[model samples]
Target chain A: MLVIDNLKASINGKQILKGISLHVKEGEVHAIMGPNGSGKSTLAAILAGREFAAIDGGSVSYFGRNLLDMAPEERSRDGLFLGFQYPIEIPGVSMVNFMKTAINEHRKYRGLEPLSASDFLKLMREKKELVEIDSTLTNRSVNEGFSGGEKKKNEIFQMAMLEPRLAILDETDSGLDIDALRIVANGVNKLKRKDSSVIVITHYQRLLDFIVPDVVHVLYDGRIVKTAGKELALELEEKGYDWIKKEAEKTEESWRVNPQ
Target chain B: MNGNICQGGLFTLQESTVSENMENDSDKILDEVTSGDYKYGFYTDIEADQIAKGLNEDVVRMISQRKGEPGWLLEFRLRAYRHWLTMKMPGWANLKIPEIDYQDIIYYSAPRQKVAPGSLDEIDPELKKTFDRLGIPLDEQKHLSGVAVDAVMDSVSVATTFRETLAEMGIIFSSFSEAVKEYPDLVKRYLGSVVPYTDNYFAALNSAVFSDGSFCYIPKGVRCPMELSTYFRINAANTGQFERTLLVADEESYVSYLEGCTAPMRDENQLHAAVVEIVSERGAEVKYATVQNWYPGDKNGRGGIYNFVTKRGICKGDNSKISWTQVETGSAITWKYPSCILKGDNSVGEFYSVAVTNNHQQADTGTKMIHIGRNTRSTIVSKGISAGVSQNSYRGLVKVLKKASGARNFSQCDSLLLGDKCGAHTFPYIEVDNQTAVIEHEATTSKIGEDQIFYCNQRGISTEDAIGLIVNGYAREVINKLPMEFAVEAQKLLQISLEGSVG
Candidate 1:
């Protein structure tokens, strides 16, 4: 359902994603593993339609349509979701109200009437249970004064409510404790359906243990250097990234010698 | 986001055109008006019967005679006008108001539309249509149901709505011009009673040539059923809007009054000196709110309104209370302090303000509380937001008189800086003549941090929404103090007023 070809992207004249290509079929989970500053977050931000980024060269297609041509809100209405590394605190805007707005906006874009107050509340209760979000937190301002774990969990709860076709989790497990990590991963597992896909971007292998990926790609220096199965994650965890760096250097030297 | 709450229905095409025009005109005017000169200084070609500027017995008498006021009110105006000559412009205020050409101001300008509407049908349609365009609901050929409004154009109140309904409740709500004519006894009894003629230069001037304003009196034991409102607009050039508003809440009575003001852009700065007095009797509560959007001079500091206002509330009877909540976002130079005099034991006074100054605007606004009775209490919350080379100062005074032994007060002043070029200063003078009185004051200043906006952006929220959220949060403490209906309106208003300042 998603296709990216020879995707090249840069922010502020600095290329971050260089000649990366990927394809994800429906219902598949793909994990992108990289060292620090491997353009993992950059990929997520580009998919979210953030401004001030030079495309350089890219053709991203989602659901057979040009994804780059759509606005951010339109992309959201098209069932594209990005779970931020750090959630925003919208003071005075209650969580219940925020979710209601988002849901109604998406519904409106789909030519549907807004949900009734009773149905909205019922759905909220259902999603809160699925994600184990505290009742007190939902009634307060959106993510304001929430702990790190609660914020991550809130993102998952929102993801459940929206039921996006494609979900990109950007470092969602960085700040979570063991318990929170388990709860978050469990929530994601419950929401996953045969038609929905997940892209897990992370620096560590801890998150992959809870939400196993169908295929894993190792990224370094703004480009993917290796692609492997889920077990490759454990291998990288034990061997560290020094081997990957040495191999990358050797490849570059051979390319220079061959002049290809 | 609630579809049910869209009472106004779809946005009108006319509204969009007006919005576009407002943007273009304001930008063009802002460019020309940046030099602190009024762009709307030129007058429209309309013949107006106006009294000469400069306060004196003659001008006061002329204004009283033009309005056909009673003999006692004319005498009162003459007396106040005479007393005005003895008072000087106060120098103690932390304001740098330019020297006003009082002699050049046309104190009285009537549109020749002074035929009182004996019945609502007699009202002119054009004037009624203007109010309709302003989003004010007025019944066809009758008064509105929920709100009583006094629409003042130039220096005179053209019409008043819902007078009969208010009168049925024994609550007197009418134009100041009509009050002087119909309720002369009440007007004379309380006129200048709190702020006398010699109170200050502007108050004295307002008392003298104040052509029209709103007057309200809530009867004993009766709560006003609707919000009392007044819309003051300055249409004529060189004519100052010196409107006076007086509200009296009798024993066990309650009332809420709201006032809004606007003016066309002008090239020469126009003077707008207003006085508002409120009195609460025993067991009474009075809330006075103002949303002032008068024209602030252009970014270059050209023509704008010089808003010098004196608003004072008197807690006269035991257990009485008064609250002043103001959201001031306009005016080129503002020098205002809505004060309260707590004289009765156990009386309460409160002041909540959100003053924003942008693009060369200057505002020196705060409040004063004089506690005289035992167990009296006062609270003041002032939020000042300054941006784009503007300057805002909060000058407050809290004095505990010698006999106010058990008085208490708490004050908090917070300033938010949008740009580094702007300035926010607080000068709080606390005088404790009574040893047993308790007084506390807190002040803080903050800027819109880049990290906060970045966090929101990472969540896919736009930059404008992020800035709006931060502003709304900073102003929640004051916005929540407003009535529910006004709180929503104020939130939207803050968003509109602070547009383009976030980036």
Candidate 2:
């Protein structure tokens, strides 16, 4: 369903994602794990078509099409979603208006008529139940004056509303409490289908326990250093990323000595 | 990386800068949207009685002679004309007003009415077609069914409706000239009582050559059954527009009055100087709303209207209330301040405004609330939006006199900028004399960031619609104060005026 080849990206001429590659098929979950600044969020931003960074070299293919050629809105209409790590606070724009406009726009792109007010309200109520977000949260402006846990849950709520083909969740569990984490992970699990895929990018293994990944990859610097089954998460949890960092450094030092 | 010189071909891989391309694309879209053509720039052809171009004693006398006014009104005009000669155009506003050649303007012009005036047949079919195209459902049966509109075309009130029902209720609604002929005592007593002829430069000019406007009076203890409206359109080319509106709510009465305007596209800048006066008696309430959408000239600012006017209301008796709501979105240059004087103890006054300037348009507008009576209260909310290369400013004042013990006031002013070229400013003046007076004021200025636009983009909403949504949200507090019918139109106007002007 998705293919990223040699995605070398940089921001302000400082290299972030250097020769990163990944592949995912339908109905599969992949976890991209790394230390604090391992280009995890940059990968998600690139896939979402954010233009803050310069794509030094990349060729992303989604559904056998050149993903880089599409605009951000076109990517969204084509069923690509990105759960922002830090959700933006837009004052004065209510959640109901924001969500309705978003859903109606998606419908329009698919050659469908807009939903009636009553039907839209019903849909909102159903999704609110799925994400456990109450009426008070959605009645106000989008993410304005919301707590950290509420913002995370709201993101999952949006994912359920969009029902995207491929969703990249970046640090969705960072600010959430235990209860919020369980609810957010449960919402993601419920929305998953046979034809959809999920990419969970995180700095910890706690979130992986709820929505377990089929495959896990350890990223260091910019490259994928290791790819293994889900047990790699439990192993990394018991022991920190020190071994992986030391080994990666040794490999770089040897490369500098041998030029190979 | 600073590139003093690319001497060794160190970093020449990319052909074009990616971020530059994106920013340029957004800026291009903004340009195209803001530069969209004005839709109501069409003209009409009709036979008319137009006076010669110039302003002098003879021209003022000629206007009075043509209207066949009584000697007292003529003397009033002459007095205002003489005072106007002694007063120079005020330049205290934050505007770059061009020197206006008063003699180069036609003082008076009206569409000729050959037949008797009470029938619709007296209105020219050509003018009717234009009105239909302008979406003015003048037909009482088809459009604005409950609202009565005294249509003013080219400074002459041509069509009047809903008067008989109002007459049964002891309410007088008619054109200014008709009021002068039928109720000269009322007109003489109230006209210039709130905004006198010696008020300002433009007020003096309007008083001297004012042709026609709407006049309304609600009797004591009576409430008007319908909304009184006047749709003023500048039809004749090069004719200076002078409109005067006088509304009086007698003791224990209630009324809502609406004023709207639009003008045809002209090559020369048209000067529009007008005055509005409202008098509220004891226990009376008056609500006035305006949606001014005159011609704002072309995108290059070649031609438009220079709108300068004086509007004021006085709460005369105790416990009276008055509110003013205006949505000003047109004109090349606008300089107006609608004010309220709280002279009655325990009276209330409110002002709500939304001013939008796109292309080369400029607007310097706000309101003044003067608390003169003890326990008087006032509220002011002003919203200014600037797009394209335009400039928008809000200048407001709130004053409490020494005698106004226990007076209170609350004022809020907000400005939003759409593009890098546009500018927004706020000038608030506050004065308090009595120690018991309480006042609160808040001001904020904001710009639409690219992140917000991109977030909407990611949700499948286009940039244009996103801008509309965001702007409407920003101005919701003020737009909510407009009357329902005008609220919807005002929203659409705000959207259309800012189509692609923001990046």
Candidate 3:
């Protein structure tokens, strides 16, 4: 459902993703693993059409449509979702009102009628079960004083509400405990459909155990140096990226010798 | 050129005119009306019947005669005018007021084109259209829902709508001048009773030369059927719009009053000093709300209204309550403190204020609550927003007397700065002589954070929408306190007043 070709992105004039390319077909889960500062978050941010990220030279296409040209909200309406690494706290806007506005904005863009009050409340009740968000917190301001686990769970609850075609979980597992991680992973797993895809960006392989990926890629120094199947993540976790770095240097040397 | 106070007799325009011809002047008049920024410089071309320049007993007499007031009111005006001469300008407010030449200001100015309309259908179309441009129509039943309106043009109240309906409900809602003529006993009994002539400098000045304003009264055991509103407009140049509003709720009665004011742009600054007083008797409740959008002088502060107001209320009997809510967004220099007095046992006083100062405007406003009887209570919530090169401050006082046992007070003052050049300050004084009294105060200052805006944009909301959402949230507490019909309008007004605060 998506194709990212040689996508290179930078923020604040600092290159994050340097000519890294990837593709995930329909009904697939792709996990991109890396050490600190591996541009894993940058890839997710760029795909979600966030500001402050300029594409140096590359293209991102979703369902054969140019995704880079769409605004952040437009991308969401087009079924592109980004689970924030740190969710914002909007002090007077209740989560219920925020969700209603977001849903209506997307529906309006798609030339659909807004959900009735009863239907909206019904949908909210059904989504609450997926991530187990507290009803009291949902009635209060959006993430005004939510706990870390509650914030992460709220993100998954929102994901379920929007029901996007491609979901990018950026560091969603960082602040989650084992139980919370299981709950979030289970929520994401339940939302999977044959036409949808998931891109998980993490610094460790812990989250992958819950929802195993179909493909694994290692990003280092703004570029993906190696790609393999799910077993590669376990191997990298057992050994380290130092071996991958040395192998990448040798490959660069061979490329210079061949001059291709 | 000399630092001289034009002392002794009133500085008359006739004397200055002859002197201008006799002397070879080297210094020109400071014609800068815009306070360094001229936003609205377009003047409306309309003929006006203006009073002679300057303030004096003669000027007050002329205004009283122009309004055709009674001899009692004329004598009252003369007495107040004489008293104003002995008072000095107050320096407690953080405002740099210019020396006003009483004779140089035209006290009473009215449209010379038409006479007063006896009914709504007889009102001039041109004048009605003028009010329409200002977004308020004089016809009450047509524009306002479940409310009566009194439209004041220049310095006089032109017409009041829904009078008969109010009369049937035992409610008296009309202009102050009309009340002095019709309900002379009530006017005489209550006028200057809450805020007397010796209360303050501005109150004394307003009492002396105030031309017209609104007067409302709810009788015993009766509740007002609809909201009563008054709209004030200053269309004549050099004419200061001085208004006086009084609302009285009798035993077991309830009433709500709303007052709004706006003025057109003029090259010379106009003065708007008003006085408002309300009294709630035993078991009575009174609510007063104001949305002031007078012309705030230009950026450099050349033109705009000098709003010096004195507003107060008294809870005189047991179980009585009084509430004041104001949304002030305009004025060149504003100095006001709408206060309340809790005199009876179990009386309650509440004040909720939202003041915004933009461009070169300056506002120093807050409220005071004085507890006298036992078990009295008061609550105050103030929000100040400062943008451009403006300055806004909240200065308040909460005092509990020794006899005020078991008195309680809670006050919260918050300020929001929109730009680096602007400033916000809060000064709250609490004097509790009663050991049994309890008082709590909270103050906070915040600015529109760049990160907050970016976060909203990351969700695809525009910058303006984001700012609106944030401001609405900040003002939700006070907005929710307004009357249900007025809350929506007040919210929209907040958004428009804070426009361009966000980059």
Candidate 4:
């Protein structure tokens, strides 16, 4: 469903993702793990079509379309979703209104009529139940004055409402408590289907226990160094990222010496 | 007639067409320049009786004589004119007042009406069509929205509805000229009680040559049956509009009044100076709302209205309340402050305002609250939005006297800037002589961040709608105070004003 070939990206003349390659098929879950500043979130942002970073080389293809050529909103209409690391707080915009606008916009993109008010409200109630979001939270402003746990749960709620084909959850479990993590992971697990895929980006191996991944890749120094089964997450959790860093350094030295 | 073209159906059709085009290709939506022309820029063709260009004692006398004012009213006009001559135009406001050639502006201009219309059927068809084109449903049958309307064109009242029903409840609803003739005692007692003739430069000017405006009075213990509304339109060219409005709420009565204004587009800037006064007696509550949409000129700032208005109210008796709500999204230059004097013990005052300036428009508006009696309270919420190359400023004052023990005041002023070229400013003056008073003021300035836009765009919402949503949310605190129908119209006006303001 998605393909990235030798994708080289940079921000402010500094390379963030260099020659990164990845492939994910339908119904599969992939996890991209790395230490701080290792370009894990950068890869997620690039896939989301964020314009902050420039693509210096290579290409990305999604559903037989050039993903890089599309705008952010067009990418969204093409069934791509990016769960933000830090959810924005838009004061005065109620969560219900925001969701209605998003749902109607997606429907418009698909050449479908907007849902009626009653139908929309019923859908919201259904999704709220799936995500365990309180009714009062949906009536308030979008993410304003929300606790850390509520923010994460609201993101999951939005994901359920959008029902995107490919969702990239970037650090969704970073600031969540045990209960919130369970709820978020459970929501994502239930939303998964045979035709949809998810890319879970995180630093800790704790989240992998809840939503098991089919493939785990360790990213270091703007490149994917290794790809293996989900067991690699346990091994990396037992031993920190020191071994990976040393290995990457040796490869760098050898490349400098060999000029390749 | 063109009124059919300006109906609600046409607006809905246009909106659907835009969204339909947007669905096919969302990428080009951002690049598309979706600016809309002014909808109320058309002029009405009518024979007018206009005074020669000048501002002098003779012109003022001619206006008074034409209206057949009593001798005392003429003397009041002369006193204001004499006082205005001694006062040079005050330039303290944060406005760039162009060299206004007062000698070149016609003081009085009224559409020629041989006799006053006794009913809606007798009103001039041309004038009725003009109001219809402006989206003001003046016909009682077509609009049973429970809003009594007083439509004013140029310097005279053309039609007023629901007068008989209100009169049955001891409420006096009529034109200022008619009030001067029929209810002279009531008009004389409360005309300048709140905003005196020597209040300011614009107030003095309005008092001197002011022609016509709505006059409303709610008698003791009477709650107004419906919202009292007045629509002001400037149709004649080279004419300066000066309207005077007086509203009085007797003891234990309640009333809500709404005012809206628009002008025909012209190349040369027209002047509009107006004054509004309100008096609330013991246990009475008065709410005044204004949606000012005067012509704001073209994108390049070629022509618009210079709106200079003075509006103030007084809580004259114990436990009385007064509130002012305004949504201003028009005028090339706007300099107005609706104020309240809390002279009654335990009285309350509130001012909710949303001021939006786009393209080349400039607005400097706020409110003033004076706490003079014991245990008085006031709340002020002012939101200023600046888009395109315009500048919007909020200048307010809150004063508490020494004898006003236990007084309270809370003020929140926020500014949102859409583009990099526009500017927003807040200047709040606070004076507290009573140590027991609790006064709080909060101000914030925010720019529409790129991240916010991207976030919305990632949710399948286009940039234009995202900006509109963000702006409406920002001004929701103030817009929610307007009446239901006017709230929707104000939201649309906000959207239209900010269109094409972003890249």
TM-score of each: 0.84, 0.94, 0.85, 0.94
Q: Please give the DockQ score of every candidate, comma-separated.
A: 0.26, 0.38, 0.11, 0.29
Candidate 4, B352-379: lDDT as tens digits: 9999887788999999999999999999
**Candidate 1 CAPRI assessment class:** acceptable
lDDT of 2 at B151: 84
Put down candidate 1 lDDT per residue, B1-503, tens digits, no spaces: 11111112111112344334333433332233222322222333444678776656788888888889888777777777887777788887666778876788888887665566786566666666655655554553454446678888787787778888789989998888888878888888888888887888888888888888989999999999998889887877888888998899999999988887777777789999999999899989999888888888766788889999999999999999999999988899999999999998899999999998878899999999999888999999999988767899999999999999889999999888765567899999999899999999988876654334444443344456555676777788888887777788778667656664321
lDDT of 2 by residue, B347-386 (tens): 9999999899999999999999999999999999898888
Q: Which stretches of candidate 1 lie over 4 Å from their true place?
A: A1-25, A35-39, A50-74, A107-119, A240-260, B1-48, B53-57, B69-99, B138-144, B297-302, B358-360, B386-389, B403-406, B416-425, B433-470, B499-503
- Top DockQ hit: 2
Most lDDT-accurate candidate: 4
Between prediction 1 and prediction 4, the one with superior lDDT is: 4
Docking class of 3: incorrect
| TM-score for candidate 1 | 0.84
Rank by TM-score, highest first.
Answer: 4, 2, 3, 1
lDDT of 4 at A159: 93
> What are the runs in model 4 whose C-alpha is more than 4 Å off?
B1-36, B501-503
Encode model 3's per-residue lDDT on B128-244: one tens digit a residue. 787777667777656768878888877778779899889998899999889988898999899999999889888888988898899999999998988889988888777888889
